[model samples]
Target chain A: MCEANVYLIDKEGNEKLLLESVDKLVPSDESIMLENIFSQRKTVKARIKEMALVEHRIVLEEKD
Target chain B: MCEANVYLIDKEGNEKLLLESVDKLVPSDESIMLENIFSQRKTVKARIKEMALVEHRIVLEEKD
Candidate 1:
């Protein structure tokens, strides 16, 4: 089984977006991606600062 | 780490609903529950026929 999650970050150094495990991650643009799952999907666009893993959730923090 | 997912079923023996993993499950009535998480939450009401685990996602099927 593959555990999945989504996160978003800004140009700073803070975590701005968090998402649960999703079925697919599609990049729509240079700074954005479409997250889709069984329930719903959302669009996230931001400068990626950093990426990390929190337990099972994927943590994405913005760059400053 | 808790890998979670939500499922919904109708009165018959068929799977009609599926949701991503949520932070909590709140039962609002005898046949419904409110799922809450960081992104969003939705209400699901149906007769649960069976429950099982597929990989990490929790599968809930309706009763017939």
Candidate 2:
């Protein structure tokens, strides 16, 4: 019904929790903006690596 | 309320419609499984590149 939690994966393949209950995602000029159910917003320099919506998990790899 | 349309981005960065109204995405062994609202299922060897849920768009790049 809602969006999944976004996690940032490091080069060593470690998963770092970024945001929770993300409701929407918007791609911007050089980054992506995330908005949660509470309207909490975060902009990240990362790209989606994988998404398992059924499992409520989203993996992203940070970029420069 | 629902999921977004899944698009495949080729090497040339062209967007090609893959699935519409995708409701769920499940990560499998080496591929990802997608399910639509009508229970339609499709498995693709791809990786998530970007998502603009508010815009109802999900971009994926094919993988070997």
Which candidate wins on DockQ? 2
Cα error, residue B21 of model 1, in Å, equals 1.7
True-vs-predicted CA distance for residue A19, candidate 1, Å: 30
Each candidate's DockQ score against the native complex? 0.03, 0.25
* Model 1, span B1-64: residue lDDT tens: 3435666645564554466655443332244343434556665554223222224343444433
Ten consecutive residues with minimal summed lDDT in candidate 2 chain B?
A: B47-56
Off by over 4 Å in 2: B1-64
Best candidate per lDDT, number?
Answer: 2
Q: Which residue pairs collide in model 2, if any? A: none
Candidates' RMSD to native = 15.1, 5.3
Residues forming the 10-long window of minimal summed lDDT in candidate 1 chain B: B47-56
Query: Which residue runs of candidate 1 sit more than 4 Å off their true CA positions?
Result: A1-64, B47-54, B61-64
Query: Residue A30 CA error for candidate 1 (Å)?
Result: 55
lDDT of 2 by residue, B1-64 (tens): 4567999987777889999988777655477788887789899987666666546678878778
